[model samples]
Target: MVFNRKHIENLILVTVLTTFSGQIYLSPTGGTFRLSMAVAVLTVALIHFRKLPVMLVCGTVAVTIPLFRSVVDYFSVLDADFGDIFRSYLPVVSFYISYGFLFLLLSIREKLSHPLSFILSLWLCDSFSNILEFSLRQLISPANIVSDVLIQIILMGLARSVLTYFLYNTTLYYIERYDRSYQENRYREMIMFISSLKSELFFLQKSIVDIENTMKDSYDLYRHLESGPQKEQVLSIAKNIHEIKKDYYRVASGLEKVLSAEEDRSSLSSREIFDLIRENYQKLSTNRQLHIHFEFHCRTPFVTAEYYPLISVLNNLIINAVEAIQQYGRIVVEGRLEGSIYRFSVTDNGQGIRPEDLELLFIPGYSTKYDTVTGRMSTGIGLCHAQEIVENHFGGNIHAESDPELGRTTFCVMIPFDRLQEVFIP
Candidate 1:
């Protein structure tokens, strides 16, 4: 085994239960410990493992400690007869039967997964086994059974069950904290990589713009040339220049998006930020010939945030909404103040998401868009990057909901106002 958390937990339970085996004797006869402690540890182990065969093997190994003690004592006192030896084995047999019965009860009933049910099952099983042992020795009477064996078993089982329940919850708490820290570190690394890429694209975009202007001037000079042998050569050169210009325009357009994403928006208000995004998308809508209505609703005129990331998040969501539509759709971007939180949403009447695919939508390298003929697809990091920025940097939340049949999807982002204030004020 690779020794993951589950394996480590199993090892701890087995070691602890076996070490405490001879510590708390509850019987007058020579049983060396309170069986309830081992039972409680076994119950916790069963909850973790859930597999019956694994639990049975672990329980068997744990019981061997106490059983060995009983065997050594019996042989040391040689005056003991066959009857005495048989009596010495009674507690071990009862302990095994109790754990087996409790396991069977839990396995059969789905509702018995609750701690209360597990504790009740433990009490009943332990009490029954003890009663059987006492009855065989003719030590059980109606009054004595109620006051002595039954009450003691119930109290012991209850204490151990409660202790084990708290321990299990504590273990889960630490595991979650560790996972959250690891994810935050990954987000920081991604942010650094994106910053470096944007810097390179910005310089490249500037150089392409200069080249495009020079090409435009050359074409204008060629148009002015007289009709002659030199004129024909100049015209051919102009044609080639025009084609190269077109290629540069396409490259520059993509670079613009990458450059715009990292713009310093630290000083922009919420309304100003939305207006900038609206202006950019308006051109996109006109170019694509898509009749998409865009609307922005902001209750608060201004809210402070790291402007670039806020812009990037809203831009990605709006673009995703626009691309989802086939020909025509309505996109509504809304912002408001809900107490100490800034809430923003993008709702689009486009091709909606499937229920099963909704959860995977924000995972990196996972996309719903695919072009079968050309074998081309989206990089699938837009939403994932947006989520990392909102949650990790701003301590916020982002989620989406969709109705596939109605072709409507809505993405919502919530950032704490105090969190934004911390970034902008300092």
Candidate 2:
């Protein structure tokens, strides 16, 4: 609840309103002010609460008195007396409450540029209801008020349903369109990151190779010496150079592994994924700490894929998860199957993605980190590549859920096991 800002803002607004209630009542424009308060409350409730329908219901109840009076005054429903105007206006108050609540609910769940169309629709519904009432009064003066109200309610509900259907589809279309742009930007970022990492590895390899050649020359000189104090010094120097060469060889070996893994990264399978992660993280112990917890919940044969590419998927995810933590942190990996669908998840306990940041998390070059801190080298390609591998390579889906306060985030990947295996075998 604390992580939700919308809810917190709603609470603060409600508290301030409570404190100023008396002042509002005494003001000349108090009646209008109260109506404004009613609208404000409904908007706050709709935006803040996930249970929008329930909030809408509460808003309806709170404004019932004013709405009922609004209609009563308009129709002269009550006996023509001192308080009769307020009574006649009651129905308008009710209409306003119901109409505002529904409009707010639709606007939030289904994004709209303006409330004009929604307001127009409500007006149409109210007009239709009034027409029905006027028609009933003319045809049958003996009819009960309960039956009339029920008919009006049913008709208005149907109109709301029709409008909701149209609005919902429009919102979904806009969301999907926005997501596509997000993915394209993410792809560009990931590609740039991969390129930079490749270049860094190449430079390290060249340096190590230069050191290796110097050591080889020194060893050759030491091999041709006579026995003396100089011989002993030469021997010691030779040993030292051997050790240095060995260390250089090790670094070169690690670089070779990174490069090899990069080759044909589009193909990899379940067990290969484990091997790739283990091998990569095993070498990078100087600057980063990586912890992997893998769970296998399905007792089935390994699903096959393009071996290297699949490795890239796991490799990219693990790297990003580690980087996100920025310090000592754990990366939890889990795998399972639901019928023929395979699910793989990686979770990290880190400074999780912020709410505003979440929408652009996958976008390219949109890092929240300072370039110096992250070495200005990260192209943010890992996640975008991971997403691509899941969706395009394996025909799967990838999604992320995060809680910044808890410092935790999880990425879920769903793939069709049978189809992937068939492609691999074929």
lDDT score of model 2?
A: 0.54
Candidate 1 residue-wise lDDT, 75-124, digit = tens? 87777564565454555555555556655755523434586775566556
Which segments of model 2 are wrong by more than 4 Å?
Answer: 1-269, 286-303, 371-377, 422-426
Best candidate, TM-score: 1
lDDT of 2 by residue, 286-367 (tens): 4344444433332343646354445556666766776776646777777666777877777889779888877776665666
Worst 10 residues of 1 by lDDT: 137-146
**Candidate 1, superposed: residue stretches over 4 Å from native:** 1-33, 51-94, 107-118, 129-151, 170-426
Number of the predicted model whose lDDT against the real structure is largest: 1
